[model samples]
Target: MTSPLSEPADDVIRAALKAHGGLDRWRNVAYVSADVAFDGVAWNTKTREHPLSHARVTVETGEQRTVLTPFLGADRRSSYSPGLAAVVLADGRVERARSQPRAAFVNDTGETAWDELKLAYFTGFAFWNYLNLPFLVARPGFAVEEVAPVKTSTGTWQRVSYSFPREIATHNRVQAMYFDEEGILQRLDYNSEIFGGQPTAHMLSGYETVDGIQFPTRREIVPRDQDGTPAAGPVLIGMTFTDIEVVNARA
Candidate 1:
């Protein structure tokens, strides 16, 4: 027997792509970069390479550091690498660590995922589709289901959710996605609770057309706390890309 979930969602997805960027534009590009800001504060910068899934993101405040050569495809090969470490709270003050020391993180949507840098890398690559451009070309890998009507300050949003399988080197992994009614990519809720007890939500806003591409100038991440409070408001940081250099002009 055939399942309705397994049926083609091409029309719905195609609507989203059109509202996002347009298939013709998306299919013509390779790599992209963006410049971001928040309330006049200079946040981090990001650049991504596609078809290869290699991402290089730099976070700067006083110290400027970068994550290089990260794998960003559906294979889930390399998440966070050795050099990709974190600083976490120890006793009262914060302590520097090589990686996430926790076992699992409880996200806003009630899902848990492994806490690691590799997961973060995969997240960046995943968001590149909606955040960087409205159009994306990739092998369809999941069943789409209309979830619910999601309303937000932006507008009334219709939503459809989808999921895919990921085989972590030693663990099993799965990713879920949510798209708006207009077919706009709205939110991605991941279950990797390795950072904290909260799910990490990578969201995009301030959509505007630039150079024929729909790009969001603002990127915000909200991570949940142990007791389930949305913790502090976003870090008031902004991201932007400039001087974008495409690796292969004609790939």
Candidate 2:
């Protein structure tokens, strides 16, 4: 299912895409929607509601767009882009919106309490970036370079350090992704600038296929030690995704 897009940066990148499904199948996908449940000390740190109940998320495939329904015990939802983050009403009215959303996090650390807008920005921005995954590398303006592989008790994982355009709202512009030998994504490393550069490791597992793509059903976000090991601390954010549906661009 090769599409018209040019080849990815290298064989490793291509292998990742093929493991997911393919760059071509990804090209025809418009969005991915799922039922998400979240828990962890993360909510307490941000001053948001702890133990978020299930929420429906729809994230765009080709760009940064994420919508979470019934945001925090309300009838309204939230919509997010790099430029704007909003609490939107059922009838298409915006209850509140913040432009240049990332700037609003200035001077904030993980210890700082957050308002709804900040919550929306961070949550939506993160999911948009996360959902895009290795596929994002296929697009322009991303610099991908193979890096030293990460080894663990189970096996060694091939890794790559990548940089994207400055405008993208991600955990960090420079980050690393580790893939299993089969080319499936396994772990991610980055420092969250909004939270005082908290070293983070996002480890993913329990893969299940949906609409020709592989998605991790379980996610663990935790603090990374100085040596790049997952610190023996809190599972900062534990997520489980279910009821996933991928919408095709052609549809």
Candidate 1 ranges beyond 4 A from true positions: 1-10, 35-138, 165-182, 224-251
Q: Candidate 1: give its CA RMSD in angstroms.
A: 12.0
Residues 94-152, candidate 1, lDDT per residue (tens digit)? Answer: 23233432222223222223234434443433333334322322223444566655566
lDDT of 2 by residue, 1-251 (tens): 22235567677889999999998888888889888988778766675543345789899876678999878766889899889999999889899999988898887766787888888888898888778887988877788899888888778899999997776788788999999989999999999888788898999999999989999999899999988898876998888999989998865
Q: Which ten residues in a row have the lowest lDDT in candidate 1?
A: 40-49
The models' CA-based lDDT, in order, is 0.40, 0.84
Clashing pairs in 2: none
Candidate 2, residue 49: Cα displacement in angstroms equals: 5.7
Off by over 4 Å in 2: 1-5, 49-51
Q: TM-score of predicted model 2?
A: 0.94
